[model samples]
Target: MNGHFPWLTVMAAVPFAGALAVAVLPAAKRTLAKNLALLVTLVELVLAIIVTVKFSPDGDRFQMTESYAWIKSFGVHWSLGVDGIGVVLILLTAVLMPILILASWHDADGPQVRMDGTAGESAAPRSTHAFFALMLAVEAMVVVSFAATDVFVFYIFFEAMLIPMYFLIGGFGGAQRSYAAVKFLLYNLLGGLVMLAAVVGLYVTTADHDLAGPGQGTFDLARIAQAVSTGELHISPGAEKAMFLGFMFAFAIKAPLWPFHTWLPDTMTEATPGVAVLVTAMVDKVGTFAMLRFCLELFPNASKTFAPLVITLAVIGIIYGALLAVGQTDIKRLIAYTSISHFGFIIMGIFALTSQGHSGATLYMVNHGFSTAALLLIAGFMITRRGSKTIADFGGVQKVAPVLAGTFLVAGLATLSLPGLAPFVSEFLVLVGTFSRYQAAGIVATVGIILAALYVLVLYQRTMTGPVKAGVEKMRDLNVRELVVVAPLLALLLVLGVYPKPILDVVNPAVDDTLSQVEKTDPKPAHPIQAPVEQAAAVTPLGGNK
Candidate 1:
């Protein structure tokens, strides 16, 4: 890599470059395209790891920053950087891309099965190279979304990703993919439009500040955060509330929480497993990420004012998502609902406004991405073998495919927040953090956790523990390659569950800095949220997982 050139920019460009390569290659050279795509993803992952290692965790400021002039007249420029939060998310995006590629290998080896009631009829693999290429392209955009420092630049990458993801789901998904793709686009674009208005509002405000202050107007978030910290920019509670809702609506729809969450089940059920992984695990996190990066940091007073409502909604989502999941017969749809429920917990932690709460939220984002990826990948593998995503279509799979059953069990247990799994630590932190702030919400969220155990365990029993369904008795164990693909994810789930400190050490400083900024601007009232005795006692020992 060139020392002066921006490595992250190179990471973004490499996938598009690969996509071009894939497009130009002869159709007969599909294998070549596949290899090239894998190489590109591997390179991207390496770049992310390099960025992580090089990041200065000691400094809460953005690292490996690149800035340049773009639209000088509007005071907008291309700027990108990463702090600890960005590092893990960027790395998570990188990690999933390769796993996705590996998950698709079996699909590439075979053909699409026609739905003419034929069980094993084969058609040519569904343009496996193109699928991988599009996935990499989406990964690149995800990286950009996480790394961009300027609001305009962030908006560009944030919105541009839909183009590729839309096609990926629509072109390569199962039945109803087209409808899912359109729904996804409409809902996200609606949110984006609102956020775009906010971005414009921000620019206007910045200009006004520049006229009165010593420096020029800028969209640099660091400058904006500093301005807020020093009271250079004063947004009234009313204006702050509106801006907060604008950003909140956008992220909520993306996070697909509660009322804004109708699109998720449809998209997940219809899209291919690989695409679903990104939609749920990676892209969706951007919404929560934005809430933390922009909503809380930029409009702390509004967040505090809105905290009670947000926590109430979050609790409702937790219960509602779980109930919906339990009612769903479609396996994919069930998982999608479970995600909504889990995300509710994440948002609750964020709005709880405690240090551990934020830490839990951050860790939840990371753990949820990995754990969800593992489940979706395995789900894809099962669907490919059994040719159905309905829970009724599976039974006693452990007898027929022990290895597949094992992976599913591991993923499902993680989903249930089993102790010593990645989610367990994060979820515990969230509840503890929430209990510290809002005892009632925390206690209710714990009920959601218990429900999680129900749905997940029931799902596992229904799918893997009964007598093998008539059509499923002959299903084969995972192939060598599939095992290789899932092994790393499974290992990490256990490793991080047991020892999350390394990741936390890096994440805590940035989280602390962000909360500190919020406090200085919107000082905590003398009376913080009061917790019930039992709930307070429950979370006291954890100390917010810090």
Candidate 2:
């Protein structure tokens, strides 16, 4: 936006610094740690907002870039920058952090005595510091992962994110924390390893190609993109598809689309709601984000070659996830399945390769985060009251806590693409865009919306309606603290639902740029040929009386 500024670097580092501060501060001083973490994230949010405000969508794809030599042996650079796409996603990451900190305040720092029964008061805060710290650390990784202009740099951040989230579940979750944490870690770790293999291939391939009239290709994505743009570097069809599949495998698992989604419901169900929100709303976004940023950008031919297969999987994930969600008894698990369904739409939009679809996919990432945050946080509140995530455990909740029920319902409606809600706008654009290319895929995917309404309304009906269940009469309405946590998200959804132009104005340009990189467009529909003597010459229908 201006002269060389390290704003991107600062935005990424602030969270890490905050985590370090939390780690070194007296563990017993829980309030200090919480306050410090909150302050750090707030400051990061402020910086992110400032940078976003300064970001002119019409400007260069990468803005406020910062580059430095790193691991020069193979020609890597610690480069950072943001296009409109990266800027918005970075904003999503920053925006969610402060809210999550607020949400976790009670859950992570509540009045629970130590299980060991030794200095219970202090232990609650001390243990929770790790939770907050890890969250912030994950935020830092997300910022860098999105903003990194270097391919290798992105890979580092990509794998780096799993560490904090791994501990967040295993360290401070439910009775099955260890099992859930291991499963989550193992799945992501394996995906990362596969991605690493691809990264290594690119490293060697770029080197051998002697790109840029030079000895070896650099890891800077900008440079590689430039080489390809100018026709200086060429990839064989086989190599392109191999690398594409490598990247796709990792992202698909992360997006947890269809078959790759088994780890998700388990992780979301076992994770604390705060962690669940972080993982589902933000972390899972990395999958689709990488698809747009790397897979398509770097391997355009392979992307086109595999578009049909990918779209089929996306459509399948949509229907499959929605169906499973409708049958889920656990509310948290249900929400997780819903995200898998939503991700199907996001991926479908991206592969549609239409300007509108990619734009909607980008916006979907932001809207999905907000809507998911509202649902998970409100669900968190409900679970805290009932001490259960089972849908059957709740009934007549709206009578006892009107505000909670209302907010939860609004969030659920948004998830189901209710009009006048944030998600509806993006979801609409995605379908409109996809229909232009493949009507059948778009139509099949739309079926998921009906299933979405079924699952959400049914969950609401089961949990918040009917006579107050046993002990539900005592459940309190949303307190100011809880209201504070969800209000901003609702406000965002409402404003965006009404006027998404501000985001789209920025998003469309990036989408166009991405489509250009992929060198693909929506194939026009076929028009049947007409004959001069059409009526008499045309083939008659099977049952027609000739």
Candidate 3:
């Protein structure tokens, strides 16, 4: 069933097809476009599921690869493949796309939520189709960003994403939509430009190594990875460091790591609830994805050299984001801040460069996507009912809307990496791996877990446990439709936590492959600094070695 057609290609094409169909239709037929988009997303999800089932975990490399000449003269190709790591993320993206579309279905219905807790009516703007179109576009771009094997293709998909997202925010977002859109675009553009410079540098360096002048050089990531691994390619330490920073800066900003993360709260605050879910829960993941794919795999030596600095920033972000989250009054904004803190754990795990760390980071990305989506979606519904995003505006939501409250608790538990939730296993693995390799950094990162518990529990207590606030008293529980949308995420959060072997079986091999490459391109020192320092004083007291 899988081999008959290029399922991956079809999956990539579905949304584009939907977009084109929607674009040509008259504004009167916007509903058709929206329906088509929903269909396309469902189809993509099914394809992803099939791909997942058929994927061979034993393969240990990219599978179902599809390659063709894109720009032959300069060695640019349209290549797509998914390793175990990429496959899960792709599946995550696919799964979320349909759910988000469903979640957003009510946005364009009409602006008329009654104070009596009745469903509201929105203005009959053509925005329903427009918003869905942009989401599909973003979905396509994000999938490509994950699946692309060519650096140039990856870069284009990476940057092309901002356009749809900008429109999603600016066109369909809240009152401050324009401001949020501009800020989101500008910050991401800056990072993209930096990444562009690094991408060009990679090709230039590769060209010189291959002795192919100008555009004659190739930009195949696998070929380059092999070259760098085998010493067939030589990138100077300074160049490596510069390129690494360029890529890291871009990804870190996208990951919204601490200082570079200011754009997130503003963007989330101004975005439609659905758009907020996609951006915070999904799009931001591309940054961490890039970190694992490019920074560690392509420039291992630089990654190793910069590990201490990266780890420092990660820990600071963990604490800083948590502090900021605790201070946030807006529920959406608080979740955005919490995402920054969670990403810190992911970045810490990646830089830790251990098998468990990398594997955990992969799983964390998947788990966070589901958890964030669940939380944001629930929050969105709450806002729709109450007409406010401020936590202080409502209370005793559990008493009024027990189903919504329960979902919130489930999602929050996952966010905090509770022991029985999906993120728990990944977060624990990350910490364990980090402790094994960088004890101090690992220990500091544990504080992030504590902070996560604090934020998630506090958020729940504020919104759900208090006495029913004036406006929230009559709110209804989640309807069957909403429950249908969130049910899978909750089930997976528990199922994966209980039995992670399914994902780990596939992910560990890829992590091992990446670590092997990292070791080759950037071998560890005979004695890591921390290991020696700990033993140094003891050895000195023993009069040194004989």
Candidate 4:
């Protein structure tokens, strides 16, 4: 797969090319731009499926790899590859793009006037071409980030993605969109700066150790990780810990873990639902994925050293986010808080240092993407119809729009990790995995589940169950297009929930490899189980046992 064809490059290039084409289309050709973008995404989806089918889970750790020299001076290369984890995430990105494009068809068509009769600075009629183009650009960057095997290549796209997302939020969002956009940019830029220092530090360390050659340095992730694992590239414990902190700081902000998470709710609250989904479901995932790919593999000793602290932060975020969600009155903000909690579970699982934890964290990323997309997109539709983001603005929505309410309920249930929904299986694995290693943290995290049910059911009851509010009388059911968006997401949630083996089969081997890189093994039980014959003998009377 590596030498045969440039599969990963083509996968990323198609969307990038489509974005440029869409961006340059004339204003009058909005429909043409939209359709072109959708077609590009669909093609990307097909390519992703082909890659997945061709990827052998039992085969090499990284398949479909492509590499070329880009910056030979610093030992940089234009490299790309995919393991099971990368393939699934790429698939997730592809599946969401066209659907989000459809959901956002009219989002940029006109200005959004405020209640005060004044359109804000950002409320001018936006270019529909730019909106869809930015989305495609985001898809391109995210896909590249997932497939990139070069540390420098990953860093470039990881930071480059902010440009499109900033425009998506500020240029096409709510009254306070500018503030949200700036906050989002500044927060991420700060993290990227810290990570830049770490990236430089890593190259310096490699040069000092002469891992690549007598004097050359390398930014190839696989090459460096191999050296680290074989003990050929020895970084001092203190330096490794510092570099790990630098990388972890950026990822935590991107993961938007607590203390660093203040930016997410505001960004989600201000941006359109589709853009919000891109941020949380797609962009943010690169953070946690990098934790597995870079932090653990490249600095195994440091990863183990920091696992306890990271898990503690994760537990706090879980309870903290759920508690805040219970109190939010804005529908979008509430959902944003819930994402923080879900991310907490993901981070916890990753640091739990077991195969189950790693697999669950990986699967949770995919499941959360679909579940959050379904919920946020449906909420966007509701907000559009009602002209309010406040939860109290609508009541008995089910009375007039039964289908919308029903679907909303389903999405909400999935968010709370209800059984038979995609998120449940992942959340259960996170807990089971965490409990096996860190029992107290796992117990505290379960409180998030209880709090999750509280917020979701309360949100539903208040908005859907009461008598119809004054302005809700003319509300309509989900039209054909809206149903198209919601139906597949709901179907995936159901199908994945009942049978997660397909995803697990792909993820487990990768998990094992990660554990091996970190030199971790699952802990043995304190109380060992007796053999079948021993148990039978113990249960039988002395004479009857013979």
In order, the Cα lDDT scores of the candidates are 0.84, 0.88, 0.84, 0.93
- Residue range 342-401, candidate 3, lDDT tens digits: 888889888988887888989999988888888888898898899888889988999989
Give the alpha carbon lDDT tens digit for every residue of 177-295 in model 4: 88899999999999999999999999999998887788888998998999999998999999999999999999999998887999999999999999999999999999999999999
Evaluate residue 74 in candidate 3 and report its C-alpha lDDT on the 0 to 100 scale.
Answer: 76
lDDT by residue (tens digit), candidate 1, 38-61: 888888889888888888789747
Task: Give the best candidate by lDDT.
Answer: 4
TM-score of each: 0.91, 0.93, 0.91, 0.97
In angstroms, the error of model 2 at 145 is 0.5
Model 1's lDDT to the true fold? 0.84
lDDT of 2 at 539: 67
Per-candidate clashes come to: 1, 0, 7, 0
Misplaced by over 4 Å in model 1 are: 1-5, 106-126, 211-216, 520-546
Clashing pairs in 4: none
Residue 421 displacement in candidate 1 (angstroms) = 0.8
Find the number of clashing residue pairs for candidate 4.
Answer: 0
lDDT of 2 at 371: 96
lDDT: worst 10-residue window of model 2: 111-120
Which one wins by TM-score: 2 or 4?
4
